[model samples]
Target: MTAFHTDDPQPKPFRVADRLREAREAAGQQQKALAALLAWDPAKLSKTESGTRTAITEADVRAWADATGMSDEDRDETLEILAHFKVNEKSWRDRMRHGRRSVQLQYNELYRKSVRFRIFQTVWVPGILQTPGYARQVFTDLNELDPDTPRDVEADIRTRMARRDHLYDSNKSFEVILTEAVIRTLLVEPPTMLAQLVRLEDLLDLPNVRLGIIPQGRRVRTAPQSSFVMYDDLAIVEGFVIDNPYQGAQAERFAALMERFWADAVEGPEARQLLRQAITDLPK
Candidate 1:
């Protein structure tokens, strides 16, 4: 068997890479042997199998399958791994090199194509529902150190506005829950917060988007966790942390967690009332 080592706290990627490595070993092939079969350098294979490099294409997976004499079923399984690899890659430098605008466009495409979006935000408003002012404040906070922060800020705002279209498009369904503290905390000045409150009021009118408010008092019971977004296919969970994106089984776990949040979540007019109270309590 191919011996592999991984230090990833999340089990999914390591498990996937281990499986592929095992398959190669079962076929009696070394990393260098497999690399030679696929006309790739041995280091590339080593990096991929070790989970150091994660952006494997379908072609690479197919080549690996061919090198190992894997059956069609095995090839299909490897293709799925390639899909997960694409979804979970978190190289921010690569994103910047390719231009974040294009990356945002691709994200928008994913949002638009998804039939359902499950999101839980523990801090500020979720991007899809944020008002432009709130979005600007958020982007500014996130990009303040960069010299091109202003341009990046504008691009991010536009990207977020584009993402908001999914809420009203009627073709997609959106289920979002926010902690009461998100409404309680003022991300910007009072007037901006007021306008953001108004925006939430407007978002409540969208038929496709279901908003749940976790009351401030409920915070103790639920235990605040880092925020995450689960796509409809449950293939990705984009964490608030820059380095740690989750996919495959890890994504599924978060999706299930969102379901639990939904079960205990308040909805209907009572939730609306709580949201209104939150706005009223904000400083004038």
Candidate 2:
């Protein structure tokens, strides 16, 4: 593992949003009233106020300042904060900066807090459900991708493996849907993949876990573009490099999107058959 540049603490986007909301309230305006005054959609206003729109637009900020009767200094200060917010909010999070182990721990935090998990995969297995052998292969590959920061593949793997314990919590619910391709695809060596299949089968006995497989021949209503996990209200798109997180209305849309694929999936004993067959089909 080489030394890689790591990212500093992430700046929260909600600071500027809080300022805008406070200003609006001080001016004695309702959210709907402000939206109407600016001729903006109420949904837009809500997203902007929620800080869930990636970055709030400068035009919108100026318009908001005008509508809310914000003084010049307050308007400039808000814009300055928004400027800083946009810089950090750009779509990439380098594991080198955050450390590979840190990322795994973050997911652990999500698993601990979320009462429900909706996971969909088209390329690789979901991190939390992976067998230790399979996860080791994953991080071993990831180790080669970046050379700047001090790396620890073993530590990261341990952190991720620990996430599996959260699945045993009977009060929590796990709904995972995978395309036929995820199981069929040789993402790792046959031995590791077979072990992963065994782990998946074992998970079936858990009362709260529901595994759904959209086997081949099924019509996909939503052409799977990428894999995502909805941990209750938050949705994280597991991109090749960046992890895009969504909350508020955006997260709700992700949950709805997962439902589209869920409709085509086979669950219960039928899903188990797919796993068993995949294990049998694995190369000896």
Candidate 3:
């Protein structure tokens, strides 16, 4: 495991550092004095002010506020800012209540802006790569889960197909890992599934796209967790009821997930062979 990275300017500027420094200065305390109060190295405080120490925890933030004599309101506001740097979670149930199209739009924007994507799926093809027939089946199944929710399955399919536009951008890259279980699962009709497999085979040949399959029975770094999407430095982990975005140490954990993906996955000709075999196995 590596230490948290604070030197990168990604995810935007470290506003927490600036806020802490301003709070300390407003309290009329020097960095050395604040460090002494918090029993931390003066360099720790200085580096944090300079945006090179972003791994500070909530407890550290609270301690700094309390030690610096910040007003309660100011401290709470600071903590709120720090919370964003940590993680943001939303219940999938609530998200779906507004209809699946909204969720699709959210990802549409995310896909539009991202330059690189690291995706892992344990039981289904990743959405962006799904064929129209396959994606329609998926949306239909989702609608079945909650018939009361308003759904325009056709519109949803169009949005999903639009997301695939990013796949052809030479400046963009994608690395996807799918478990063997996902390949064998028959979610759609045999013809639709076979077509989806054909799409995967073509995607595998793209210079900027890499597809890997973790064959069954292979040892891996960790048990498969829920499928998730890693967009640049941000990681969006899908849970049973919620989708969680992890940053800081939590986001760094995706590195381990990536390792698990590559360690057990077969790529290049091996992946192509597996996909072709799957297509052949589809019902006649």
lDDT of each: 0.70, 0.80, 0.79
lDDT of 1 by residue, 200-240 (tens): 87777789889887776554445658787766644343343
Clashing pairs in 3: none
The best candidate by TM-score is 2
TM-score of each: 0.63, 0.68, 0.66
Give me the runs in candidate 3 sitting further than 4 Å from their true place.
Answer: 1-98, 239-241
Error of 2 at 49 (Å): 30
Better of 2 and 3 by lDDT: 2
TM-score of 1: 0.63
Q: Pick the candidate with the highest lDDT.
A: 2
- Per-residue lDDT of 213-265 in model 3, one digit per residue for the tens? 99887678778868988887778775332355677688789967887679889
The clash numbers for all candidates, in the given order, read 0, 6, 0
Which order, best to worst by TM-score?
A: 2, 3, 1
Cα RMSD (angstroms) for every candidate in the order listed: 10.8, 10.7, 12.5
Count backbone overlaps in model 3: 0
Off by over 4 Å in 1: 1-91, 145-150, 219-221, 235-243
